[model samples]
Target: MSSVLITGASKGIGRAIAIELAGRGHRVIATARRPETLADLPVDQRLRLDVTDQESVDAAIREAGEIDVVVSNAGESVRAPLESVPLDEVARLFELNTLGALRVVQGVLPAMRERGSGRLVFVSSIQGRMVLPMIGPYGATKWALEALAETLAIETGHFGIQVSLVQPGAVSSGGGERAKVHLKDNDPYSALYQELPVLRGEVVTPEAVAATVADTIEQPEPPLRIPAGAPAKQVLEARKVAPEDKPFLAVPLNW
Candidate 1:
């Protein structure tokens, strides 16, 4: 059985993935900001990991040791237009969504390279490929993730390390509906956000994304990019075939 380590497993997609992988017989190591929050996860271990902290990341990886699959699933987003986004909030988003994953990959990759076999999966978003006005900061971070994952896949191929990017369309974590982050005065993209529709009825569940993640990880040669939802698939297809399409920009109201 392969050992799989997931970051941000306290709840949502990360929690679902942890549960599914554990059920599949993999030795699952789940980490979150608070270990107690993940006490109910059916995994081999639940760890306390604040992805923004270097020490926390280092300790978690050292403790998990010899992981066959590393899934970077931690992320946070502040919803606001480019003009309204606060500089500090933007930095924090990058710290969690992009750099946090990069740090985890850096910590785990050496061991994987030495073992000559491993998989690294990054949870990105459809926004990574397309730009939306208020979500520019969040989308910027995912774009960075895509760049990093693609580069790692090319660089680590000879070392028998596989890197894959999982781009999911909007997912309903339930908690997301209640998540409120601050936006600033300068963030003028409010009009754009107001124009976009919200998906009140059709949102992909965390469980669905988790199952897709499990399948992707188990593949012997997973592709560089895996779309985890129908919306994600559609956006990815459009990005690949028709670079000019911008339908996803109006996804705020409904995609």
Candidate 2:
């Protein structure tokens, strides 16, 4: 069994992935900001790790020696227009979603390169490729992440390390429930905001996403990117054929 380390494993997709891998007999090391939250998880180890902090990442990596697989699943989302979203909040999102993943990669790559065998899995979103209303800030981070993951795959292939990106559509994770939507009463995008609910289609479950991640790990040669659900796959296909001026709508009725 391979030793796997997953960041942000206390809840949502991260938590589900940890559980799935552990059930598959892998030695899973789960990390979250609060280790207590991971106390009951069926993992080999639970460490306090705040991906936004470099020191925390370094300490966690040092403690968990020789990881065979690293799942960069720590990320956050902000729902707001690019014009109205606070710069500070956008910065915070980038810090956690983009830079945080980079930090973890840096912390784990040295050992992986030395061993000449490892796998890096990044949990990105479909928004990484196609942007929607009110999710621009969050989408921008994923876009950057996709670029980073793809480049990392190219750079690390020679070192016997594989990189994979799992992009999921509107998953039924607590992220939607906890999302911070910012909009003034007379916002110009009010109509679009009203239509937002209709834009969201069937939600994929976290367990399903977890299964995809596990499958990716088990593959001797996994694809560079895997869209986790029907919604994601359909939207991505639409993006390829849809004109630049005519954006594809997520709502099935509109499609």
Candidate 3:
């Protein structure tokens, strides 16, 4: 069984994934920004890991020992029109959702490389494939993560490191839901936010996303991308049907 290290495993999808993997007999090292939050998790190890902090990540990596799989599941989202969203909020979102994932990846890659085998499962979103008006920043972060994970797939393939992006839509536990943040009350895009439908189809459970990730980790050679629920599958199809809706809807980018 692979020794799996998960970021943000204290609750929601990350928490569920840790439990599922541990139950399946993998040695699971569950981590969160606050180790205390991890006290209730049934896993092989619990450690403090703030993906946005290099020192915290380093400490966790060293403490966890040899890690065969790194699930970069720690992320936060902000809801707002791109124009009205505060720049500082955007920066913080990227710092955690984008750079935070990168920080963990960088911390673990050398060890995985030395061992010549590893798996990276990123808990991305269906929004990574398409954009909605109110979810610009959140989608941006996921899109960025998708790019980084894909690049790692290519760069690390020869070394036997597998990368899979598990894109789930509208997770049921409200994992990705965020309070709308605008710089002012008289925002121009208020109507747009009110009208746009962000959550479509059936909401996925944290366990469902966790199962998909567990599959990715356990597979001898998992696919480069996976949709964690029907909604996400629909999102991809929706994009294909309306390419003009997203002209540069090429194989790169995120929220």
Full-model lDDT for every candidate: 0.82, 0.90, 0.84
Q: Which stretches of candidate 1 lie over 4 Å from their true place?
A: 178-189, 198-202, 243-255
lDDT for each residue of candidate 2 in 1-255, tens digit (9 for 90 to 100): 889999999999999999999999999999999999999999999999999999999999999988999999998887788888999999999999999999999999988999899999999988888887888898899999999999999999999999999999888888877888898889887777766667765689999999999999999999999999888888778777877886655554321
- What's the TM for model 3? 0.92
By summed lDDT, the worst window of 10 consecutive residues in model 3 runs over 246-255
- In model 2, the clashing pairs are none
Task: Give me candidate 2's TM-score against the actual structure.
Answer: 0.95
Candidate 1, run of 10 with poorest lDDT = 246-255
| Candidate 2: clashing residue pairs, number | 0
Q: Write the per-residue lDDT of candidate 1 for residues 4-92, one digit (tens) a residue.
A: 99998988899999999999999999999999999888899888888889999999988987799999999876666565567888898
Clashing pairs in 3: 138-255, 139-254, 139-255, 140-254, 140-255, 141-255, 142-255, 143-253, 143-254, 143-255
lDDT score, candidate 1, position 24:
91
Ranking by lDDT: 2, 3, 1
Q: Model 2, which residues run further than 4 Å from truth?
A: 245-248, 251-255
At residue 133, give the lDDT of candidate 1.
55
Q: Against the true structure, what is each candidate's TM-score?
A: 0.90, 0.95, 0.92
Clashes of each: 11, 0, 10
